[model samples]
Target chain A: MSIEVENIHKQFGSFTALNDVTLSIPSGELVALLGPSGSGKTTLLRIIAGLERADSGRILFNGEDTTEHHVRERKVGFVFQHYALFKHMTVFDNVAFGLNVRPRGTRPSKSEINAKVMDLLRLVQLEGLAQRYPAQLSGGQRQRIALARALAVEPQVLLLDEPFGALDAQVRAELRRWLRKLHDEIHVTSVFVTHDQEEALEVADRIVVMNKGRIEQAGTPDLVYDHPANPFVLNFLGNVNLFHGRLNQPGADQHGADENAVSYVRSHDIEIERSPQDSTALKAEIRHIQKLGPSVRVTLAIDATGEFIEAELTRDVFKNLGLQQSEQVYVRPRQVRVFVEDYQI
Target chain B: MSAPTTTYAAKANDNHRITEPALVRWGLTVVALVFLAMFLVLPLAAVFSQAFEKGLDVYLTALKEPDTLSSIKLTLITAAVAVPLNLVFGVMAAWAIAKFTFPGKNLLITLIDLPFSVSPVISGLIFVLLFGRQGWLGPWLDAHDTKIVFAVPGIILATIFVTFPFIARELIPLMEAQGRDEEEAALVLGASGLQTFFRVTLPNIKWGIIYGVILCNARAMGEFGAVSVVSGHIRGSTNTVPLHVEILYNEYNYTAAFAVASLLAFLALITLVVKTVAEWKVRQQLGR
Candidate 1:
């Protein structure tokens, strides 16, 4: 199903959780709502699922207005962050719940319900544990069961709120790969909320970065990572070294040469050398050096501004240049994205 | 002087041992056993011993009396009516209080627990004031020719009033702890509101409901102070088992009185057993 959320707003007492947010999701695409805590990503997902009512908004599912639909009528599958499985139900029964609870006229036969539940359990790779209760399963297994149960309804859209948020780091990685594979097989329109940027980038076809109840950027993972729309997206996606200074060169774009312009360069973007041959090269002193696998992380303290920046170099390059701690060096930016300081808020 | 200091140090080391002395442990155990015997064991023994004092046949005969039989029937009927009514109220109240947030929620909870703090006799008296001839709503009730103040209905009302909080008190904490996530999941999965309640909410809280119902049933059957005030001691009609026991005791028929009291005690024992089982089931369901 294609979902279009138009100007959604939500508030809890004095705090505004979501503010005039709009997003459109195409059919059979997996999108990730990526943000830090209290960023309103989960709130937006819940609004789409009809679990929460937006103070003012219109939600259209495949050209049908679903804002007035009850949660039962929405036909949206929602998986909670905590794997909210029924504690008293067996895995099979939990997966069969939607089929069994269908209104009598449209309800499936008993044999069909059994076969469908078994198929779902197998799809989640939990067919052998159908008799086990949720409490008996590991956190990862319970999460898959929650997914299978959500899928049993044959929903138009699937929504998950931090689907792997509660698992350990190792399990989280495995589940991300597994979820991507599962999405490929089902090809359902799916949205999942996540705080882990790596998980979002690895699993989702598209990422919507949010902060402070607003969408900072939305694009393919590569687009959002390489071309962040603002400072928040830049800082949130990956590690960066920020240089706060005035633009010295003239005839730049009108918006690019402000006195408070901040230049952001990824760690790998800074070129380091022993001699200052280029006019753009800034003098710096090497503060620290650490061997990180095949790369050497060099922390440089620029002499002109007394500001610190990091450069990641291959070990072979470091050895060829004979670099060492407390050594003097010249640093030049290979690439940088500059933004005004006023863009923070 | 050095020898004396060394010996004194050894004695101090003995006193500073981590575990308590064996004699103190034994002494504490003996004291706890004595306390238990005095408070629990003695009273239970007294009840059973005094109950069979005359003879088995005579004790059985007392229970077989028409008035005694009628009192037992009255108690059963009261519990049958009161327990189910309160069970329904308990489920509804717990659902409303735990699953949703609304204005005046705390006030509603406090009102539900009002009977716990009020005296049982006062509970009966409140009902009496509402239904009695000289009290509020009395003239209308009189004109309608409904006899509630000194009848079976009055007894049932008093019993219900006193036991109203038992099931709800057991349920509120349990339901609140279980939370609303499962119900929401069910609803999102295309289950109707009623279906979600039955399939998700009710199953999760089944043990709590059973635990509450047993306690409610016990209180409904054994209530004395409230029932006595409202019953007016109508022989074979309004007197419950507890009231009948009081009547027999007041008349100096100690054996018969104790015999009737034993039945109430037996009912209490059954309730205790069921409560233990229910608690165990709840623990199992919670995966504790």
Candidate 2:
């Protein structure tokens, strides 16, 4: 099943949580609503799940309006950030809750529920912990159990609000990978809300970046990252060096590529050398050097503008150059992207 | 050098400890114990001691009196009617207050504690003004041939008025701390609204509800000021145990009055035990 949200607007008192937001998801695709706190990603996800009502808009499930439907009538699965597992219930019963709460005509038999719940437990690799209550499990274990519970009902759509937001760093990374693999295996239409950009880039098939209750951009991960439509998306995606320099060279305005006054450049796109023969090259001084595992980052300040920028170099290249702090260097922009003043969302 | 350093460390450790001096600790303990003995233990012991003053046979006869037995029944009935009604109203009010936002929310919360701020006598008098024979509703009730004042209904209403805030006050903070995340999760999982409440919300706050009910029921059975104003001191029908005790004492029936007073004290003791157990259960649930 596919899901569509159109012109959704939600407000809490005078605060606008979502503003004229619209998006559509194809069947079996994993989409992410990515933004900072108070950016309304979670509110938009809740509206799609029918847990929250929109101020004015419609939600469609395969082209049929479900705006006025009750949450229980939506047939959607929702997972919370804090893992709202039933503390009074054992893990086995928590997973079986959806099946047990079904109406009499469609309810499964007792043995069938047991088998299905056990199967879900095994799927989450928590079959051994089935008899344990939620309080007895670790945070990672509880979240995994919550996911298994959300999946038990065979929902047509799945919504997760920061599913890994509460886990520690190590467990969060592990669960992120596990969730991606699980989605590939199940392939149900899914939308997850997260503020972690790396998670959106790594796990989601499509990323919708939001800012101040507005959709900044929505596209494939690389499309939104490499070809961000506006400055907000570019700055929010990752580390980048921004500049506004004049370039009167031949194709500065002709070719679509190098329309120099390169508005922004990624850190890796900034190239540094000991010396350059070209007059157009910018002169800079190295301020600091940080050696990461396989790459070294050189922080430099432009001698002319006093502006700072970062250039990432391979370990092999850095060793060959023998660069040091306080050293004079020439820098060049290897790749450039422009964010126009008249940009539209 | 090492010896001097060790001695200095020991002196610093003594200063670091937060323990009070022996003299101060003992003084505070003695003061508290003296006050408890003077104000609490002695009065409770006197109730039992005076009941047995006329010998075991006389105590037994006082308890067996039909007036005393009927008063006990009336007290139990008042609590039986009042406690459950307040329990339902308290849970609904707490749920609405803690989980939803609407106009006059702060006003509603302050009003829930209205009975607590108002004197029990005034609470009883308010009902009397509404339903008594010479009051506003008196003429309408007389035409309908219905009697509310000086009746069991009036007694129950007064008891309920004084105890209504107990459960709601207890549950509000607890339900607030445990946000509505679980309820929303249940709803998205296809559980109906009623199912979500019974399965999720009620189970989460069950211990709090029990603790509140114990306190409310204890107060309902022991209420004197409110029930006295409305009950009119009828012999059998409207005389609760507290009112009966007062009447017997006024008539110089000391032995019978003390006998019933001891029973009320026993009820208080049982209430403390159950309240503590329920509180401990709540602590354990939260600790998890």
Candidate 3:
């Protein structure tokens, strides 16, 4: 079901954890709460899961008020960073625990519970390890078992708190893809918390970038990547060479798309050459050169303004141009996106 | 063929070989072993020798007497009642101390360990002042026709008070070491607090609780001074094994007294075994 979080506020004594944070996820949508640590992403997730109550907020589940509901009554499943499986129980028992703890008057038959646990085990690809304890499972296997356990109750919403944060890089990547596939098959409305930008970019259908207890940007992957709402969103999302220069004109040549007139160019949009071509071109001194696989990242500083910029080129281009450190070079912007500058988004 | 080279290689191997520590450690270890044998082993040897020197038939006959049988039965029954009750209380108290930061928490912890610091004789006196025939609650209880002192209830109360902190103290460090992540995770998984306690919290603290209960039971079965003061030491009625041993000694029944004392000591030895096994099991589970 669709979930709506309206103007949520939370404070731990004097520390304001989340400040009037608000967002909505449609039914069957997979949203990622993307932010660095202490940015209120996990706090927001816990609020939605009903693990923590907000100082002021209204949460609606399919237009019904669920703010006062306890976590058990919320029908929301949660998977934690450490997996939180019962160490004394076997993998089978761990997965069956949620179903076994069903509310009064709704207890399932033993056979029904067994069948559901088996189905979940197979879904998580841990069918062969049903009798093994949580202590006997690897990090990735334990997390999968945790996921299976969370899904056992057939919850309406699933919340994952950095589910892959504890795994090694390779395992994190593998589980990230597996989670996306699982979400696609199940089509349950889900929200996952993560501080890793690559994970948020690759796994989620929509990304909500948070900073300092506020939403900096929220959109589809392409929308955020191609059109970040502000400097924080852009710098947090990916590598970008930022230029701070005033726009001289609004002509097509200057590539200023907005009237207010300052522009930011992507590192990939800056072209470096041996010869100057137009009035837009400026001479810069090469400060540093780094070879990255087939490309070379050349850091350049403009001579006139002493402003720094970075440009990426093919290794072949670097060889052809014969650029050296401290050598004079010509640089021009191939494309620029201009936006209205504001302190808040 | 290469005699000189082979000699050099042998010398190199000798230089690289690890040398064990010298004889000083071995001499100290032998001294320590002799000291342990003299101080710890000789007394136990004397107890066994004195108990059994009269032969099997005499020992069995002494053990089969109604007084001795009742004492053994009483100790077992009291421990059975006290251990499980302490186990439950211990876990709840440990959870409170380890997980929550509340007012009076430190005071509560200190109160829990009060029995350990106070003399068992003093402990019994405090209870006597509160529950004795002429004490504060004594008249009220007598008016209601209730009994607390000089009975089975008195023995149980004395045993419970003395052994109260054993299990909780053992579990506090363990629960603290595991931290709060798993419990919080269970809370988030739609498990109510009770369900979370049973499924998540209980399993982690199970070994520590077992170890603590074994120690408490061993101590409860052998407790003398407190139960003596509270129960008035009525023969075959309020006499636990330790109290029974004291009575036999007073009556010039030295052989039977040592025999019964040795039996209680055997139970204590078994408790040690159980505690060791519990620790090993905990380590095995942690290894996983």
Highest lDDT model number: 1
Across A167-191, the per-residue lDDT of candidate 1 in tens digits comes to: 9999999999999999999999999
Off by over 4 Å in 3: A103-115, A240-345, B1-20, B24-28, B31-39, B61-67, B97-103, B142-147, B177-195, B247-253
Query: lDDT by residue for model 3 over A1-345, one digit each (tens)?
Result: 999999999998888889998888999999999998999999999899887889998999998999999877898889989887877889998888877776767878899999999999999998999999887788999999999988998889999999999999999999999999999999999999999999999999999999888888899988888778776777687655544554442442343344454466667778897778877887899999999999899999988889888888888878988999999988987666555555332
Roughly what TM-score does model 1 have, to 2 decimal places?
A: 0.90
Calculate DockQ per candidate and list them: 0.64, 0.74, 0.47
A264-303 in candidate 2: lDDT tens per residue? 6778877787788577568999999999999999999998
TM-scores of the candidates are 0.90, 0.92, 0.84
Residue-level lDDT of model 3, residues B227-272, one tens digit each, is 8888888888778999999999999998899889889878877998
Clashing pairs in 1: none
> How would you encode candidate 2's per-residue C-alpha lDDT over B210-268 as one tens digit per residue?
99999999999999998899998889889999999999999999998999899999999
> What would you estimate as the lDDT of candidate 3?
0.86
Clashing pairs in 2: none
Cα distance off (Å), candidate 3, residue B138: 3.6
Error of 1 at B149 (Å): 1.4
lDDT of 1 by residue, B192-215 (tens): 888888888898889999999999
Candidate 1 lDDT at B177 equals 81
Candidate ranking under DockQ, highest first, comes to 2, 1, 3
Give each model's whole-structure lDDT: 0.90, 0.90, 0.86
